[model samples]
Target chain A: MSDQKEERGLRELYDQDPERADYLAFGRKTETDRRGFLKGAGLTAMMLAVGGAIPFARNMPSGLIPSALADTPEDFTLFGKTGIIIRNDRPVNLETPAPLLDPDVTPIENFFVRNNGGVPEATADPEAWTLTIDGEVDNPLQLTLAQLQSDFETVTLRMQLECGGNGRAGFNPSPRGNQWAIGAVGNGEWTGCRLRDVLQQAGLKSSAVYTGHYGADPHLSGEPGRPSISRGVPIDKALEPHTLLVWGMNGEPLPLIHGGPLRVVAAGWPGSCSQKWLTRIWVRDQEHDGPGMTGLSYRMPRNPVPPGAEVPHEDMVVMGPMPVKSVITFPDTLTDVRADEAFEVRGHAWAGEHEVQAMHVSYDFGATWVEAELEPPTNRYDWQRWRARITLPAAGYYEIWARATDDTGVMQPAVVPGWNPRGYGNNSQHRIALNAA
Target chain B: MRGRKLRTGLACACLGLMMAGGASGQTSDFGGLPAGPGQLETFGNCTACHSTMIITQQNFSRRTWDEVLTWMVEDQGMWEMPSETRQIVLDYLVTHFGPES
Candidate 1:
């Protein structure tokens, strides 16, 4: 049928002049319809017979395009594919508790997958990447992603990256990290260009004072060839103007499974310094031997190792920032009671860079304490979301606890000071047991 | 004649980019296996960066894939094959995924 009347006359000439569409023109064109210009010359001769004169279909190379449809928001449910779906769909328990997601965002699809080696190769050329800041710098730059978007000044915050063994399955006998469950920790916004405006546009010479980074992903597969993960910061958290080097997220771009064009969002530390798919930065001046820094791998033994203890080989250290915690999340654990009904005690409280400031519920296991209803100030280490309301008066088997307190008084430590060999900070408190109507 | 219709539209756009690179190297699933006698002559070099689900999601044991192939050939540069092709890719990954034995 004359190519279906030349595709209904080129969709009625792009529904009648869609801004003179020549497929949104790149230039030179003047066909004037010889039957929809021979249907745009038979769809440009069927796209040059299926592309550049088919040298075997021009090497069919445009594949691997799923990072949730690259660049976000197809009704943003955090890049679906079931890798991160959460809106109260709970199931996170890497080893104890840590599932917060909105007290000020944690959704990179509920962040927290911490792999020492896995999930890399989301490429299709993020503009053929390249960052490379270079060790102990004076000038060694390299950039390119259109020279970091026509040279610097981009900013955009929202922090909280997490991962220092994010609750290593509550460690008691199980150590060795990556049991991760508090959904590791996310919150993005990001939009790049900062790490102190590219380390003060590469000048820093007061003996640098640490910054390190590095990430091109690779490694795993019989492992070892260096580049997988690297960490560092503390040149005053790399000059903190909201320490970045991102490359957009949440608002788009950045999504090589979350770490596209670049990464290193830091915020308040532990998520092993937020270094994903990045690519070198260096700067050090001392102390940062990388390899998860002076080995003992993400340490943490200041003291607390008895439940099956086997750590020896010298007390450990590193794994820092992350303590005041809390969690209960809706009367879950025993539900179905009404002898005296009176529920409502939602959960979520965090600490890391400080400012959770309160959250002290207990009910009957910690024995005494009550004061929940927090959810203010969302950023500066993120995570505060809370909600309370309890009053049973009769029913039996109950427990319910939660405990938080930051802004530097640093509370929430009912027990945890031991489980090293790689099971970093596992703040202890959350307890749920519901049942009353 | 418009330069022979622009040299027949650039020879039909170079035969449509060599027939889309021969229909994407004929649907690459590591494009047809064959080279297996072993000593790991790079059985498609770590599947060009992984997937054998990183050696069948390892449970480990051929002394942990020979201490992870001797730490990726002495600290991450990997590619020093021939110790009889790394004992035939550590004997076909501990004989078809070790550890369960």
Candidate 2:
């Protein structure tokens, strides 16, 4: 693509999704230009540098920079009993263990951390941190945590928040972003005021079609004017009873790593839609094009393409709710099983925007499958617990596969659904290898 | 505390390698990567943005690795490596972490 063409494409992208355009633009800006840009936006570049300016180069020890940085103290625990994988440290992208996510309500600690930019240096103080609701609204409002609590009814609900590229590692050709396994998702109880009620308080104008969320996190390049992530959702989805400006998780104050103080709990949509460390909500006349919104960030090709084929931006569609998927949480891979006895296989199944209708288990590499008993979902948007007992027909190395069907009758594909440039949704069957002795 | 211990352990390992005259060891304690030609180059170039864990976890063909490197440089703002260095790093990655059946 020519430079002019790319620039035009980016401008078009900004028109549609400014957040994603800003994300892309942040990396392209030269250091000199970046400083000028930050100053133009009324932000101090020095403050951003102190906040965490891509420390990988400056802090790296002499010789080869270690995989894990030494001088930089870990802001949070990087590993747990679940054997969580650390992808990056500065911005902190941690993946949960798939086999450890059997619980219906994922513990806040176990929930995956996906940060696009550096954590803000300013520690959140609920008393002082305020959320501004403005743009295309009849009554713009600036409400603090206290006002948020006293002014609206607080409700709690269990919901699943999943990265759009949760299973990017499963792609054959693979993608360039974070190579997440099937662990970049979690179901949690979020307590907050309904986004609809909060929006109604601001009184949305007739032209409001989407929203743009702003958060405290700084860009990875340490640009103060740019947000790490600032995506939004449609007005209807924003107004859903379940959409919330959440302050608590699992009955406790929201953890900073998980976007504490205030965050949007946009259940069912890609987790990017739920902006963390939320500080502002801008109602827009069109789609809120924020970072992670354009150029295959959270968008996927509408139709499957041959592996490694490049598709134009026009053919891509924004990823909304995820697909039906299941994870084998018990009888982990390489587990030893007695051939003479029947053993129970257990796991969790979830379908975004739709309830899981049924689940099936296959012991012979999906040659044959048997229906498994699925416990009803405890709450809307929560994963369903599933279990099945299987008697090994013969002693050998066997693979157990789990497949879930959603209420829409869409079943999990046996392999990656389709090849996209970025590997957006890969809800293939979950397989666990076991030793049947 | 754990980070400090890990750094100390890595230093000890490197010293041991130097004493043994094994300039290039088979594995590194840095990110548990297998040491080979261009390993240091790869680490120095890539770890500036992400942890070695990200690269170590991926298993891809040389072609896919090349594509990933191109995407990083062209889209993700990774500094473009010299052609010869890129080839050496690509070879090391392909030999150590090629596609799995």
Candidate 3:
């Protein structure tokens, strides 16, 4: 459309005030909101008339907001989300800024979102959701949301959900996916019923060796029957108490963007394993071969590969629990602190399926290290917050690096770890830079 | 204090709302991609789904770009182009969009 002018205006407003500009630009949902804004503002008709049509025309829903027309970052904002960097607007992959991830239990607002498909329209009324438990189960139960709540005993646990590609951006030679940094990880106090209880009630058959998960999100290719992504966990993992059919996040109904109503909360694993808008759990006799489960989606190379070597699908191994990782929260990377000032350097550290036993801070690269006070996690999967007092005598520019060692004594690599095709699991030490002028 | 620039990421140049009050027009117009033979085809095909920001953000080897395209077609359901057109796009991508370049 001739909305180069509108984009210019919106970008100007955004530069001045991001939230306000966001509210003005987005802040509207529902077909009513879409029709009301577009018809009244006449931008929709203007866009149609001028551009003929948008690209990926087959994929856009009726009232889809054109993100390409957006001013900066993205032209899209969901209900109650801010400060997230939009990786891809089509499937709604969002990454939170590392500085904003300071809280121990990530609030719904601050939590990152990684969607393989558009949010299902069924999220509008989550109460009507139905979950089917079939395939290798003695008792296949079709449970509704109300039935699930009434039947299962609910429990809450603080745990971490990280994307397998959380550190893909750090990979050399550059991978071809969302270039997420450390922001793809978050720890949240999730409240839901144990998956074990449900499977136990359903009575899993001896044939069940794994579980295949299915969600209601639509395919990105606009095919009605094509699944967006179907992934799952091993049988033992699916039976963990921490692996939950989550409905509440930080004491609120899981926000739709974060996979609300009903979804999996398999902590310490790839967030994809915790399928959002969960609808089905297929107990399988073998390893699940779903869309995201195939080839190199979440698999890492078996042997260490050089930076740009091609890896065969058969040689890769499916990633298990994430490795030990940490990030500095306070004194953001862009921060400017006064010289010779003593301040508390604080952050959070976690190991997938492991407890972080020690945390260290390096002021002058890895040449020397000082121990930070690390707190014991409330649960096995919860990230432990660590803090230390440090003074910079004089600063031109300084980087503070954080390293965490798991109970098993595995330390985060100082640089990007070995590379894989899809760039999974690079738990390099997190470093933040600050300047003193 | 550094006077109002929190997000100084050189790669994330096109944030729609949380902007740095800067020129993002470059991101749409090929992100300053040099003029080449297959530039038009690359723009139409690549930007069909994502922004040029996604493209320019990458600093890859020619082989990696090929793998990326192979994934796009095989896994991500990208429409298959003619072999000739594919080679042109590949050559253009490898030439202008390499680590050294």
Model 3: what TM-score?
0.81
Task: Report the C-alpha displacement of residue A5, candidate 1, in angstroms.
Answer: 47
Candidate 1 CAPRI grade: incorrect
Q: Write the per-residue lDDT of candidate 1 for residues B54-98, one digit (tens) a residue.
A: 343233446556666775566545666658777777777666555
In order, the interface RMSDs are: 18.5, 14.7, 14.9
For candidate 2, write residues A1-437 as lDDT tens digits: 12221112222333332322233323222233222133321122212212332222222222221222223343213322124555544456777777658777888667888888776643646867899999999999999988998889999888888888888877877665677878898889999999999999899999999989999887654445877778999899999898999999999988777888889988778888999999999999998777777766788888778988778878988887888888988977898998978999998888888899999999988889999999887778878899999999888988999999999899999978888887787899988888889
Q: Is candidate 1 or candidate 2 better by DockQ?
A: 2
- Candidate 2 TM-score to native: 0.75
Better of 1 and 2 by lDDT: 2
The residue-by-residue lDDT of candidate 1 on A133-219, one tens digit each, is: 867778978886667766888867666566676656566554432344344565556778778888788888888888778787665
Candidate 2 regions with alpha-carbon error over 4 angstroms: A1-76, A79-82, A122-124, B1-49, B55-101
RMSD of 2: 11.2
Tell me candidate 2's fraction of native contacts, as a decimal between 0 and 1: 0.12
The alpha-carbon lDDT assigned to residue A377 of candidate 1 equals: 56
Docking class of 2: incorrect
Q: Is candidate 2 or candidate 3 better by TM-score?
A: 3
Query: What ranking of all candidate models by TM-score puts the best one first?
Result: 3, 2, 1
